[model samples]
Target: MTSTPGNSTEKRQFHGDLIQLRGDRAAKAIWRRVPLASAGSENSIDEVALQEMLFRHADILALGEIDPAYRNSVPVCMELGTRAGAADALYLTPTGRIVLAEFKLWRNPEARREVVGQILDYARVLGSWSYDDLDREVRNRTQRSPCDIVSEAHSEVEEHIFIDNVARRLKRGEFLLLIIGDGIREGVRDIVAYVQEHSGLRFNLALIEAAVFRRGDGEDLIIQPRVLARTELVPRTVLVRKTILEETDDDPLEEHEPSPIEDENERFWRAVLEDFAFDDPEPEVPQPSRYGSVWVKVDGSGFGGWGLSFGAFLNRSQSGMGIYFTWRTGFPEEERVFDEIVGALSSNEELGSRLEGWKRWSAPSGPPRLGFSRNVEFVDGTTIRDFDEAVGWMREKFNRLVSVLHPECWRRLRAKG
Candidate 1:
C-alpha cells in the first residue's frame, strides 16, 4: 500500500495467478487452479470438504480486519442448525461477532445465487434469535456453553458482557457473513452490489474465492490455498460498524477513571505481560483485578482440562506473586488433578527438585487455591520501586514453573491416570 502526494491507487501485492519462483530456474510452477469438486467416487473434495477445511484452519478467512477480536474466535460448529437452514460453518469471536460462512462450489450462476440467498436467510434468522436460542443450538451440537467457547480463548471477557454482546450483535444483525467458494468467477461485484442494495440488513459480507492448487497425484501431492477476493464493505454496513465503534468507545467501564489500586495493578501486569512471553498456544491475557489477585490462566493439564489451569498472579495485597492452582471442593475435574499433582511431587524426585521449597496451604472449604509464592517488597509509595526488575523475577519463575508443572509432570500423570 502506497500513495502519491495527493492521490493514490490501491493495488494488491499478489494477484491474477500464483507462481513459484526459486532463483534462475524459477517462475515455472504455473500452479493452475484446482477446482474444489468431487472428481469421482474415489475423491471427496466437495462443498462439505471445503467447510471442514475452513473450520480446521479459520485463520485462512482473512477476516481479522473486520473485527480484530476475531483473532480469538473458535469454530462453533459446521452445519449449525438454523431456522433458515443449517449454515455451512459458524465461528464465535471473543467480542461476540457471529461469523456465518457459507462454502460453495461456484462453477455456475445458480450456485452463486443460492449461496448469496442462503447466507442472507441465515443472517435474517440469526438476527431474530436471542442468546438462549443460539446457545441451545450450539450446545446441542458441541455440548459447550457459549461463554465457555469464547472464554477458553479469552477468559478476560466477562460472561455477562459476552452474553450481552452476542445478544446485541444478533439483534442488530451485525454478522460477518462469508461466502466462500471455489474460484468465484464473475458475478462477484454483483454479489457485493446486491448486499449493498439491501438497506434493511446491516451485514458485512465478503466473497472469498479459494484457489486450491495441486501439483501431483496421491502420495506426493502439493496443495496450496489462496484467497483471491475480499470484502468491499458497503456504506450501510460501514455505518452500522461505525455506530458499534462509537458505542464501544462510550462503554460505561471505559468512561470512568481507574482507582489507585487499579492503576498500580495495571502497571504491574503490563510490565510483566509486555515482555513475558507465554508458551500456551492460546494464552489467556490478564485483566487488572480490583482485589489485585488476577491469574494469567494457563492449561496445567496437557489434556485440556478446563479446571486444570493455573497462572502467575499478584497476591491480593500486591506484596507477593505466585503460580497458583485452582481447586474446587468435590469437583471430580479439580480433585483428580490435585491428586495427580500431589502424587507427582511425592513420587517423582526429579519433579520435586525442579519445584523445590515451593510452599502450599489450603483452607477447610470449597474453592481452595494452592501455589508456590514469591514475596516482593512493596515499600515504594503506590507501587514497588523498579517494578521492571520485579516483573523480570516473576517472568523467570513463570517460564520455569510452567515448563515443570504443565508438560512433563502432567503428561506423565495423564498417561498413568
Candidate 2:
C-alpha cells in the first residue's frame, strides 16, 4: 500500500505476501505481512467525515439485516433541533420505528463521558415531542419533510401510516438509539450500564465502533464498523403508554386483514363521500386508511399554519365523525388560533346544545389535529337504514361547524387561500 505522511505510532498494520518456500517443503506457498493502512493523526477520523460516510453508504450499517422486523427503512433526517448538541441522524424502520443515531469520534476522554449523557438528553427531549413536532423540527432543520424524503426513495411506504407509526414510537421512546464512534475508550460500558439501570427510557442503545483506514489516497478509504455494546440483555422498562407490541388481542387498533364487516364499513364511507359537499375549493376527498380513518382536506387552506378537514373514525370502542383543524406547531399564532377555536366551540350555546354529544379537543402534542367529534357505530349491528338516520345527525353537525363555532375563522382561512 502507498504511504502518506502519518504518525507511525497510530497505525495498525495487516501484512500478507505470497512466497515459495524451498527449504521447508518441495513447493510450499506462504503469505508474509501485508501492511494495510495507518490510523494517522489524533483527529484522523473526524465526526463530520464519519457521519457523511455513514449517510452515503448507510446500507453498510445493515440495520435491518441485524433484525428482520426492522427492515424497509432509511435515514430520513440529520442534525435535528437547535441546541449545542443534537441527534446526528433519524431513521424510519420497517414498522415505522424512529432509529435515533449519534456519531462521535471519542478522541477526548472527557468528551466520551459527556457524549453518553448528551445522547440520553437528546433521547429524552425527542421522546417528549409528538410526531408532528418531530416532523416540524426535521423540516425546519433540513427544509424537507422526513416522510417526503423517505417516501421518494421508498414508494411502498404509506406516508400517513408511516408517520403515525413514527409518532407512536416517539410517544413511547421505543426506537433504537445507535451510538457510533471511533475510539470509544474504556469504562464507557459501565456508564451505559449505569444510565440503563437508573432510567425508565424504553429505547435500544447500541455502541458501534468504526475503524477507518486509508490505502494510498483518501479516495480509497475503508471503514470497518462493528457493534461493541448492545442493550438486548437489558431488561425491558415499562412505559406509561402501552407499546404496540404489548397490546392484547382485544385491541381495537390491532393490525389484521380487513374483515367482511370492515368492507361494509368502507363501502358505507364511500357512499357518504359521494353525497357530502362543502364550500372549499376542490377539497381532497376522503380516502380509506388501514387505521379506520376517513380523511378529507381543503387544498389551499394548508398554505397557512393550518388546514380545514373532516374525518370519520371507526373502531370497536368508539366510532365518530369530526370537523377538524389541522394546526401545525411552530407557526405564527398557532397556539392562539387553536385555543381560540376550541373556546368558541365550548362557549357557543347554540352549537354547544345541538352538539352536546360532540367533544372538542386537540392532539396531545406536536402539530395537533384539533377536532370536534360525534360518535356513531357503523360496524356492530347498524344496518344501512340505521346509517341513513345517522347522516341527518352528521349533516346538522357539519352545518353547525360551518355556520356557527367561529365561522369567521373559516372565512379568514379561505381568504388566505
Candidate 3:
C-alpha cells in the first residue's frame, strides 16, 4: 500500500510524547510493554514491524509460546542481521516473528537428540560471530566490498562460514517465545527457562494478554502488553556570570635634560678656542719710544675673541678708521649689557641714528643671546665679501668687550699673547 510521508502506522504509534524514565529504567519499562500475544503469537503481528523494533533498540524479547512452524523457521529474530545477510531475502514468518534459517548436519542414530545437539552447535557458532563479521559477510555476498576485508587478530572466517551452513541446528537460546492459543504452554516456559539457564544468555520476557473481541459479525484478537511503572524527576539548573573592566591612564609628567647634540657642540667650540691659544706665539713687550695709540673697533657677533686682534691688524693703516674692533655677545648677560649700550645710544638720538644694522644671535632652545657692533662708515657692508669679514668684526668686538667687562680677562689675553 502507498503511504504518505510521516503517515506510516509506525510513525503514528508514538507522537508528541515525553518518556520520563531515567537510564536503565526506560530500557526495562519499554521491554515490559511489548504485548505478550504479540511476542508469543508469531502470526498475530507484522514481522517487519517486530524486526524493526528489535533491530532499532537492540532489545531482547521473551516469548510465552509460538506456532511450531514459525518458531522453527525464525529462531532468533533480528532486523539488521537478516537485512545485512540477504537484502532481497524475506526472513519473516506468516506470523510477525523474524525467521532465522540455515543448513546443518547430523550423524547419529538418535535423530532428535542429534538434531538438538546440532542446533545447539549452530547456535553457538552464530553467537560467536560478531555484528561486524556478519556485515562483512553480507558485503561479500552482494559483490559490493570496497576492498578485501581484513580479518581481525582474533577473528576466524571458518567460524562465520560454519554458522551460516547450519539451518535446523540453529536455535534462539534466550530469544522471546510467543505462545499462541489460550494461555502460555507449560512446555514453552520450561524451554525458555532452560534456554535462559543452560545457554548462558539473558532476555527480557514480555507477557502479552490476548483476548478475542467479538462484535456482531466481526471478531478480532486484541493484544496489549502490560504497561511498566515509571517515575519522573526534574534535573537541577546552574547559573553563571562573567564581567570584565579595562582602565587606561596617562603617565606622570617628569622633567628631562637638554639634548646631547647641544652639549657636544659647546664642548667642540671650547676646545677650538683652547687650541688657538696654544698655537699662537707670545707677544713682545712694547718700547716706550715706538709706542702708538690705535683705536680698535670690535664686533662680537660672528667669531669670539680671536677675530678682534685680526680685524685690528687689517685696519691698522686705514686713515680715519684706525684699528676698528667689532664683536658679538655670546652670553645672555653680555647681550643684556650690549642692549643697555644700545639703549643709551637710543636715549641720545644723535648716537642712535649713527648706529648701523645689528644682528641679534640666539641659540634655538637656550637662554644665551649675543649681538655684533661695528662702525658703519669704515666697514662698508657692500664691500664685506663673505662670513670672514663678519667673523673678524665679531671677534674684535668680543676681545674689547671682554677687556672692558673683566680687566682680568684682558690680562689673561695679554699674558696668553
Choose the strongest candidate by lDDT: 1
Weakest ten-residue segment in model 2 by summed lDDT:
247-256
Kindly list the per-residue Cα lDDT of model 2 for residues 1-417, writing each as its tens digit.
654555333342232344547786787654332222224534254567678778666676767644555565577777877344668887776457777788876654576787888888887776666655676788987788787777777765545456557755665656677787765544677777787786655676777766665543334555666766666523334444665233322223312344344455556666555566644334444554333455554434444423444545543323545555555545544445556666765788765665456555544234455446655665443233367766566555554554443344555555545
Model 2, runs deviating above 4 Å: 1-43, 82-84, 233-417
lDDT of each: 0.63, 0.58, 0.29
**Pairs of residues clashing in candidate 2:** 14-34, 15-33, 15-34, 16-33, 16-34, 17-32
Q: TM-score of each candidate?
A: 0.50, 0.50, 0.20
- Candidate 3: deviation at residue 114, Å? 13
- Give the C-alpha lDDT of model 2: 0.58
- Error of model 1, residue 379, in angstroms: 46
**Candidate 1's error at 363, in angstroms?**
23
Judge candidate 3 against the unseen true structure and give its global Cα lDDT, from 0 to 1: 0.29
Best by TM-score: 2
Candidate scoring better on TM-score of 1 and 2: 2
Per-residue lDDT over 41-133 for candidate 3, one digit per residue giving the tens place of the 0 to 100 score = 643333344334333322122222332333323222222233223321213222222323221111112432333333334433443443334
The 10-residue segment with the lowest total lDDT in model 1: 247-256
